[model samples]
Target: MKTDLNQLEPQALVDAFLKYPPAGFQVHEPDNFLAFFYTRFNLLTTLDVALHQKIKALPGYRHWQNMLHLQTCFVGTTVTEYTLLSAQLSAQQMTEFLKQHIQKTRLTIIKDLPLNSPFISEMENNYSQELIKSAEKNGFLSVEGQALAYVPIDFENREDYLSRLSKSRRKNLKRKLKSLNEIDVEILATGHAKFQDAEFTAQLYRLYLNVYHQSEIHFDLLSPAFFQAILQDGDSGGTVLFYWVGTALAGFNLCYEYRGNLVDKYIGFNYPLATDHNLYFISWFVNLEYARVRGMKFYIAGWTDPEVKAQLGAEFTFTRHLVWIRSPVLRFILTRLRSVFEADHHWHQQQELKS
Candidate 1:
C-alpha cells in the first residue's frame, strides 16, 4: 500500500521550500522522522477586522496583544497541501510528536489537516481522524479552516465547461473572458531562459507583494529567495503563466503538474491593470482549459477567495487546524471566541442555508 507520504506535495518541492521558506519561518528537525516550521506569528491576522478591533479595545489590550504574539511551530510546510507527516503514526506516536514540540512555542498549529481528499488513501483518511481525536483529547482545539477549492477537468472544451454554470454566470464569465483576446498569455516551465533575468524575476516578486499587502489578511510574506529558488529549479514540476498587455507584464500564476492534477499555487498581478482586464476571471478559465487540454484529472485551486471560487463552479474540500495554546487564560479566551477565527466555515454554512 502506498503510504500517506507518497500522496503529499512532491518531496523535492518540500526540500526546496524548507531551504528557502518565507520570511521569519525556520525549519526544525528535532528527529529524522519529522520537520517543524517555527515562526513568530501575530494571532490577530487570523481574525476579521471587527473582532480584531474589539480585541484591541479590550482592557489591557496591548498587554494581551503582546501575550498573544505567538511563538508558533507548524507541523508541516504551511503551504497549499495538507499537513504531511513523514510517516503515519499511531495515536500514541502522534501524541509523542506533539509532546516533543508543544512546549518550545507559545502555540503549536498543525494546519490543513484534510478532513476529505480524493488524493489520499482510505488508510490515511482513518489515521487522520484518529490523530484529530487524539489531539483533542490532549487539550488541542480543532478549528475549521478555509476550504480548499478544486475543479475537475472533464469538460470537452471551454464551451462545455461554461454550459454547466448558471446562465447568468455563464454570460458574465464569457464577457470577462473576452479580455483574453487582447492579452498575451505565455506558459513557461521552471528553469526557463526568462527566469535567468534578475530584473524580470524581481518584477514578479513585487507583484506578489502587491497582492499580499492589499489582502485583508497578512500572514506569510514570502521572500525573494523563495521565488528565486522555485523559478530556478527545473525539476520541481513548476509552471508559470505570464499574462502580458502590450509589452507590459500584467500578472503571472505559478502552478505545478503533479499526480495527474494541475495544482494552482501562487499568483501575482499588477492590479488596476489586472482588474481592468478582468485577469482573475480570465485566468480561471485559462487554468481550467489548460488542465483539460493536458488531460489532467483535476485543477487543484489553493485555499482563499472561496466564495468567488464557488461562484466559478469549483468544489471545495475542508480542513481543520489542531491548535495547542500553552497559556490557560489565552486558551479560555480562544475557546470563547473560536467563532471569530472560523469565518470561512461560517460563510460556507450560510451558503448551505441559503441553498
Candidate 2:
C-alpha cells in the first residue's frame, strides 16, 4: 500500500529510499512491488556552449528545453534510479506493465540509469546489452548522459592514497593544504553540536545558490529545507562538515552513508574566500580522509566536471537513460535529435589527457 513518508518510522526511511522513496517524490504506485513517477520542470541545459546554442536555434526546441525526469531524492546527481521489490516477475512482464500503464502518462522522459548499477541485476543479466535491447523493445530512445566520478577508497591512510597520484599533483595538493593551516575543519554527524544552527543553515543555502546560478546546466534546485531536513532527520545517515576561519563559515559538504559507500552529495562555499583558500581541493582531501578512517570501500564524488576529478585520480563511470516519448511525432523528432542531448564525448576525451 502507498503511504506518506512522514508517517513511516525513521529506520524505514533508508529502506523506503532504497526500495520505494516517497519524500519529495511524486510517485505512481502500480502495485506494492512497483512504483514510477518523474520530477517535473527539470531544465535540460548543458555546459556545452556551442551545442546549447545550436539546440536552442532548432525548430520546436522549446519543448525539449524542459523535461520530466525520474525521481532522484537522496542519490545526488544520479539522474534516474528505481527499486523493484520482488524477483518473481520476469523482465518481459515488467516491461509490458510499463508500456500498458506508464507509456500512457505525460512523464515520458526516464533518465540517469547507471549502466554499472547492481540494483536491477536480475532484470538485465548483462547490464549494457540487455538494457539496450529492453529499452528498444519498449519504444524508448536510449542515450548516454553525464559520466559520474568516483574514488575507490582502497588506501590505508591519506599518504597511501596520495602516493598513487602524480608527483606534481601530489605536491600541488600538499601546497594547498599547507596554505590553509589556519582554517578549522569539523565533521558533524546528524544532530551534532553545530548541526542545528539556523543562521548557518541560511548561509549554506545562499552559498549553494551562488554555485547553482554559476553552473551552465540547471536541473534540480534543492531548497533550504531539503538541506536542513537531511541533517535533522536522524536516520537519513547525513552528515555535514564545516570549514571555519574562526567564526566565519567558509564551506560545507553534505554527505551520506549508504550500504558501505560514502557519497559526497552536496557542497556549498562562500565565494572569493573559497577560491583563495582552495577549499575545493581541501574538501576533496578531507572527504577522502574521512572515508579512509571510516573504512568505506568507495567514495562517490557526484556527477559533472570530469576534468578536475580525473586530475584528482578519480575514475569515471558512465550513465545511460531510456527516454520514452508518448507522442509519435515528438518521438521521431527526438530519435533523429539524440546527438544534441547526449554527453559531449570529445570534451571527456580531452580531459583524459590531464590524467
Candidate 3:
C-alpha cells in the first residue's frame, strides 16, 4: 500500500504496521543491524507491537502522523520500529525526539537502540529512581552501557554449585553422551546446514514436533521461514547452532556473540532418555566449553529457571531496565499502569497454569 504521510491514521497506522511492516527491515548487508537483531530476539517484536499500539492510541502524536511505519521481517536477534517523523522538524529537534523515545517509554520499540543517545548521560547519573522502578515493574534487564558491562553472576559460592551434583548425575550424563555418541549422534551447527535442503531440515523439524505432541507446555516452534532466515544470515557471517543425535536432532541453541558473552538466547532438544538424558545439564558444559574455546567471559544465559541454573554453577546476576518519557504526566501514568499490568498478567498466568 502506498502510504501518503498526510493521510496516516494513528490506529490505522498501528494496524498497518502490525498488518504489514517493512520488508527492508530484514538483516541484509545495509540493514544487517536491524536484521541480525530481530533474528535472535523475537521479544523485540512484542515490544515493538506494544509501542506502536500505545503511541497510536496516545492523545496527540502528530509527529508520527505523517510517517509510514515499516516492518522488515528480517533474520537475526533484533527487530525495530522506525519511520521518518518529519522533514519539518530541525535536525536538533529530530535528534532529541529519537533520543527521547530511544531511552524512555519502554524503548523496546527499537532493538539495539543506539547508546550515544542522552539516556547514556542519565544512566551515568546513578539512574533515576523512576527508571529503576519502571524496570522492576516490567522485569527487563537494563543495559547501562560501560557503567555496567555485565550483570553479576548470581551464585555466592560452591554449596549451591555442589548441590547440582547428585549420587549418579555424572554417571548419568556420561552414559547419555556415551550412548548417544555410540549410536552415532550427529552434532552439527544448524547455522552451517543447508536449510534450503528441506529433507534435511524436516528431519530436525519432525524431532521438535515430537516434543510438542508429547508435552503439555506451550512452545514457540519455528516455521520454515524462521529457519531459512537463520540460514540466509549464516551466508553472511551470522549463525544459529544445533546438535543432532544421529537422524533424530537432539538440541539447538541460537545466539549472537559480541563483547565476550555467548548469551544462551534460546534452545530445543529431544532425547530418548527424556529429561534424564541430561541434555539440559549438558547445556551448561556445552556453554562453558564453548566459552572457553571462544575465549568469551560469561554465558549470558538470560533469566529463567534461575534457581536450577544457579545450581549448575551460574552466578546470580542483576541488570536494570529503564523507562523514560518525554512528559512527566505520561511517565506517571505509565508507572501506575505498569503495576496494574503486572498484577493482571500474573493473575492470568497463574490461572493458565492451574487450568
Candidate 4:
C-alpha cells in the first residue's frame, strides 16, 4: 500500500520543486534524489494561540522571540499532499543528511513526515518512527504535530452519512445545507479551457491569497505558479469546484481524485460573501456528496481546522516533525518546552470527548 517516491523519475523531482517551491523559499538542487528549500522559520508557528499570547505577555517576550527566529532548511515540501522522501533513504542516512545540512543553516526541519499512513508500508512507517527516535537520540527536537483529517465513504447516500453523526450535529449541518439552494455550483477539471486563460488563472491565485492571509497560522505561502501548474496538468486528476452567487465567485475548492479517494487540497473564498452564505459547511457536504456519488472509498479532507472537521464527521490520523536545532543550548531549551507544540494533539483529544 506504500507509494514509492523512487517510482518517479529523478528529473520529475527536480522539475517539481524548481517550478513550484514554497513561497519565499530559495530552492536548492543538492541532488536529483532529494528536494530541499530554505527559508526563515518562526518557532512559534505551531504553538496554540492562547498559549502564544500568554508567552507574549511575559517579560522580554520580544527578545525571546527574536532569539527564536531561525534560518532553516526543510527536507520536504509543505505544500505537497504528503511528504516525499526517496525510498532508499534510511533513518541513519536522513540523520546524517540533517546533521550536515544544519551546519549551514541555524536549523534543519523534516516537516510533516507521516508517523503512520494507510498508503505507506510498515517498513516506511517504522522508518519514520525510527528517524524521529534517532533525531531525538542525537539531541534534536522531535515534535508530534497534527492530524490530517479524513472521512471514509461507507454510506449509501448523504442522508445515511448524516444519520451517523450526533442528532444535534446532523440537524445543524442540514440547516447549513440550505445555502446550496442560493449558490450555483460548477465543477471543472484540470484540462478545462478556462484554466488556460491568464487572467482567470491570476484571479484564482488572488482568491488563494485571500484565504492564506486570513488564516490563523501562516506558513508555506504557495506560489501562483503552483496553482497554474495544477490547473493545467490534465494528468494530475485535479478537480476544482466553483461556487457562484449571481455574477460573483463566492468560493472554490481544488481537490484531486486518486486511488479511490477524493483528496481535498486547497481552497479559496471571497470573505464576507463566503461567510454570509455558510460556504464552509456547504462545501464540506458538497465534497462528501461528490465522493459518495463517485463511489470513492474515502474523502481526504486535509490538515486544517481539525475541530471544525471533527464536527463535520471527519476522523483523523496524525503526523510528526523532526526539528534539529544547531545550538545545543537551544536544543536543551526546546526539549524542556516541547509540550508547547502539542496543542493540536490536545485539541484532537477534546474532539474525541465530544464525539
Compare the candidates by lDDT and give the number of the best one: 1
TM-score rank order: 1, 4, 2, 3
CA-only RMSD, every prediction: 2.4, 5.4, 13.0, 3.0
* lDDT tens digits by residue: candidate 2, 1-355: 3322111123333343434433355545444434444554342453366766776788987785554343221111222222222344444654565567554554454455446553224334244445456768878777776766778888888788889999999998888887469689987887664658888678788988877777777765666665666556666677788888888888888777766777777788888888788998889888988888888877878776777887788887666666666668767876887776665455666666754
lDDT tens digits, residues 1-355, model 1? 1124524455666666677787888886554546678888887776766778887899988766776677788887755488776454676687776877578577889887778677666666776788889989889999988888899888899889889899999999989988999999999999998999999899999999988888877777888888888888898788899999999888999988888889898899997999999999888989998898888888999888888999999988888889998889989999888888887788888989998
Each candidate's TM vs. the true structure? 0.93, 0.78, 0.45, 0.91
The worst-scoring run of ten residues by lDDT in candidate 4 lies at 5-14
In model 4, pairs of residues that clash are none
Give stretches of model 4 more than 4 Å off.
1-17, 57-64, 353-355
Better of 1 and 4 by lDDT: 1
1 versus 3: better lDDT goes to: 1
Q: lDDT for each of the candidates?
A: 0.82, 0.63, 0.39, 0.79
lDDT of 2 at 204: 82
Clashes of 4: 0
Model 3, CA-based lDDT: 0.39
Query: What's model 3's lDDT at 77?
Result: 25
